[model samples]
Target: MMRPVVYGALAVVLAVGPEMAQTRPKEAASVPAKSLADYSEAMENLAEAASPAVVQILVQRVAPVGQGDSQHMGFVAEQQATGSGVIVDPDGYIVTNAHVVQNARHIDVKILRVDERGQAPHGHLLPAKLVGLDSQVDIAVLKIEGSNLPTLSFLNSDTLRQGRLVMALGSPLGLQNTLTHGVVSATLRQLKPESPMVYIQTDAPINPGNSGGPLLDIEGRIAGINTMIYSESGGNEGIGFAIPANLAKDVYLKLRKDGRVRRGAIGVIPEAITPALAAGLGLDRDSGVILSDVAPHGAADAAGLQPGDVLISIDNKPVREVRDLALTVFQRAPGDELKMVIQRGKEQMTKTVAVLERKNEPNLLEDQASYDAALVRQLGILAVTLDEKVTAILPDLRRLSGVAVAAVPAEYAGLNPGLLAGDVIYEVNTKAIASLDELRAVLNEKKSGDAIVLLVERMGQLIYVTATPE
Candidate 1:
């Protein structure tokens, strides 16, 4: 009996050991290793893991200015807007775009229960309060009434590589619970030269209601927060951008603490290194940022750095453009030491610059943009009030004062020829528009089809534009 038991044990070891050895090769494979045939199934799993955290943001606010009957000017009419958001923390902290809830009187966040066996699932609607908003970065934080809520973790966007698969989960055009898959086309895309935040560009179908949604990577991590699209027709043109999730997380934490973003200001004004400037300065590269001015006694000034130094990197990270430098500086806090690499007349040297808090310094990069909420739409011109913020961005505007053009609707854009966003309207039909009320008073004098001349200021020059409103 003992001999037979020994033989049986030897047989068991031989049979089981061969199978175990086959399973555990020199390289350990992922548990339940994905077969090549399960590629489509993997994407489905990613969406399933993240879908439960995507929330629909519904807002009710006063109707956009000039949206109602012409007879009832300034009448408060109810208007509704729809967008998307994602729960980032288990305690019900939601992340969304600032523009979505800006000035909204009421906000509702709907949490979805993901369905694995079916195609659609109903969600729970809960009231959410705006915790904080940073319109500059276009990020907002909201608090909902729940605990142990479904949440998604954010991945460091710096690790994102171009051509990696990403999925945009949101509500597009009021269609709830939508998912679109695409690959990252570009990273570090900036809208302007001095934009403090960089974007991840993807060829995804992001539309009106898709703002503030989560852009998830294959691992179901939040890579970015869907923000805007570059479209000529006001529709998805395959160019959608997202705020990096890392930036969104940082903004969320700071906004929660102080209700606003506290940025590190080095007090160095940088300009794009254009071809002519590069050639003149003998810079081997023509793309990096150049320190044009260093404010007296500021962080950059205290660091023994001088003007005309080409900034090449920060903290050993390469700074390829002006936005890159600005974004890195914005990420740091006061008293943080930043390691910088600069090209000084063919000599590449590294310097340590201390970051300081920005005190009342105007964010010069904030563009003077208009919104429909401030303009009467029939005139097809959406203008915004120009104040210190606008003047800071365009120093030339400091001397001029008036309402700046934010948008020109397409229908009346041709009629109001030469009118463009950023053009400050100093006067409307001979009446100076020092304030919004003054501009409204001037427009109250106009009749249908009446010809109007606007004294507009654009880029240090003044001109008169004529238009007739129907």
Candidate 2:
């Protein structure tokens, strides 16, 4: 019989004897017992005790407009997707991945039940509703109403150390309550531009339905939430990533309180100080980020940072590159106060900047020196230009305007690294761009050294492309 892994609030220290013991027999006698030490062995204990709290999520999602439904039927087709979730509160607050329950019209949650052999696996199915979802971090909270519901306590994910033993609990490929063991492969991985910007990379085998499942340390503490995988085979190739539980908890609380996560930024376009720029700026080292521009009324503007300023640190963390600044600022909430260190015109200064939330709409930056119009165009295509080899297999995209392929001219070589011309341009940067004028309007404010995020639509697929203008 299969069972859900044990997840609980207080660490259970197994004693040498029956009643007081939470520690396994092999544990060193002098070491203090913390939680369930043998994750694999604790699987059955958690399954037997906490199985009712683990749930199998089934979502019925409405098909999109062009999703190939028979028009004569008069009803859009519904799609079903499966994933795993954990009940986090007795009031029925459940936590899962935002991508898992995205667009779900109906959600069914199945709790585990004990069989005759004393194995607890999937059993009862109940209805649930979305409480809040934060797509940026890929975390979602759900709730089901009932009395005496089982809940799991959140562990301090920040305490997790790299190379520590851990386990992943989820329904991988619909295998309810499956357990896989691994070590903390890596930590603080930045895979997205969004806030709470860190992930716990693990070697644990995670599958499609494993999204939103818990990544538990050996002591049974929730370390992260399994989210994404880097795979070409469309399956786990031993490379999986999870949103660190600390970041997830922060996002969860924000989502629970405000129904959305509000992020803050310094409002200055930043880039890693290259060797050339470092030398041009007369810097001793190329180990800091260069402040490119400060937008009008932007946070950095109010803080008095200038375009030529070299940003060395933020909140005491060295800003060696753009990713460092991005990941640091993204971890902050809107309205949070931040300390920055900058070198400006032969003088070093410190400034306190009140980070501000960026608007959902695009804020164009003016650059009269460059092109006639500095605009961000949304083409809604996720594509890269065909290389000599790829051109043989992919068709050519020409004569499309308003939004078209981004040419890889000398200055634009690294703009859209992974996109090709055949990819349809659906969105210019982040602004929804339907026409060339809209793209132009958005770009009127764009300047050099800005990393533009383009949302592209290609081959009926959507992808985000990050480009920086030279």
Local distance difference test, candidate 2:
0.67
Tens digits of per-residue lDDT for model 2, 9-76: 22244323673354544465545455445544576665445446667798887533432434432223
Model 2 residue 139 lDDT score = 88
lDDT of each: 0.80, 0.67
lDDT digits (tens) for residues 1-470 of candidate 1 = 89999999988767777668687653456644557438779877877778888999999875435544465443445689999999988898899999898757789998886457775657878999888787878998989988888899999998999999899999999888899989999977777754687899999789999999999898889999999999999999999999998899999898788666766799898888888988998888767789999999998999878999988889878887777788888888778899998988879888899998765333312223323356555455666677765554345563456876666544344345577666778887777888766777777778888888888777678888887766
Candidate 1 local accuracy as lDDT? 0.80
Best lDDT goes to which candidate?
A: 1
Clashing pairs in 1: 370-406
RMSD of every prediction: 11.6, 15.5
Best by TM-score: 1
Query: How far in Å is the alpha carbon of 163 misplaced in model 1?
Result: 1.1
* Model 1 TM: 0.67
